[model samples]
Structures are given as structure tokens and as C-alpha cells.
Target: MITDLANAMSRCRRTLWQDALGAAALMVTLFAGLHLPALF
Candidate 1:
């Protein structure tokens, strides 16, 4: 039982890390899209 719980927690942490990275990428692209037009 404890092992199952640990496995689940590890999986959740990995997913959270992936989600955070995706969110950071999205924010970077969004900011670039918003600011790049002004540079021209």
C-alpha cells in the first residue's frame, strides 16, 4: 500500500513538472508574440 502511494506521488510530480514547463513555454511564446510586433 505504501509503495502504491509513493508511485502515485512520483507520477503526479512528474506530470506537474511537465505541466510547469509547458506553461513556461506558453508564456514565453505569448510574450514574444505580443512584444515582437512593436519592435517592427
Candidate 2:
């Protein structure tokens, strides 16, 4: 039904959002790892 479709869409959106956040965190960590040693 319509409700099931809505629920599925919301679940997919949540998963994508989490993935984006995880990717951002990973990028930040990688950038810092590459740059921090030069500052020390």
C-alpha cells in the first residue's frame, strides 16, 4: 500500500544520510592524518 512505500522511502533516505555522514567523517580523518604530521 501507500504507507509501505512511504516507509520504504524514509528508510532509504535515512540510510543515505548516514552514509554521507560517515563519508564526511572519513574524509576529515584522512585529511587530518595527512596534514597533522607536517604541523608537529
Candidate 3:
């Protein structure tokens, strides 16, 4: 039972980390898209 719980926790952590990275990448893309137009 403890091993199963530990495995679940690790999976959750990995999912959270992936989500955070995706969100950060999205934000960076959006910021660049919004600001890049002003350079003209």
C-alpha cells in the first residue's frame, strides 16, 4: 500500500511539473507575440 501511494505521488509530481513548464512556455510565446508587433 505504501509503495502504491508513493508511485501515485511521483506521477502527480511529474504531471504538475509538466503542466508548469507548458504554462511557462505558453506565457513566453504570448508575451513575445504581443510585444513583437511594436518593433515596427
Candidate 2 per-residue lDDT, tens place, 1-40, comes to 9999999888798588888999999999999999999999
The TM-score values for the models, in the order shown, are 0.66, 0.66, 0.64
Measured by TM-score, how close is model 2 to the native structure? 0.66
> Which candidate would rank higher by lDDT, 1 or 3?
1
- RMSD of each candidate? 4.9, 5.4, 5.2
Alpha-carbon lDDT of model 2: 0.93
| Of 2 and 3, the candidate ranking higher by lDDT | 2
Off by over 4 Å in 2: 1-11
Q: Residues 1-40, candidate 1, lDDT per residue (tens digit)? A: 9999999888798588888999999999999999999999
Q: In candidate 1, which residue ranges exceed 4 Å CA deviation? A: 1-11
Candidate 2, 33: how far from true, in Å? Answer: 0.2
**How many backbone collisions does model 3 have?**
0
Under the 3 Å rule for N, CA and C atoms, how many clashes does model 2 have? 0
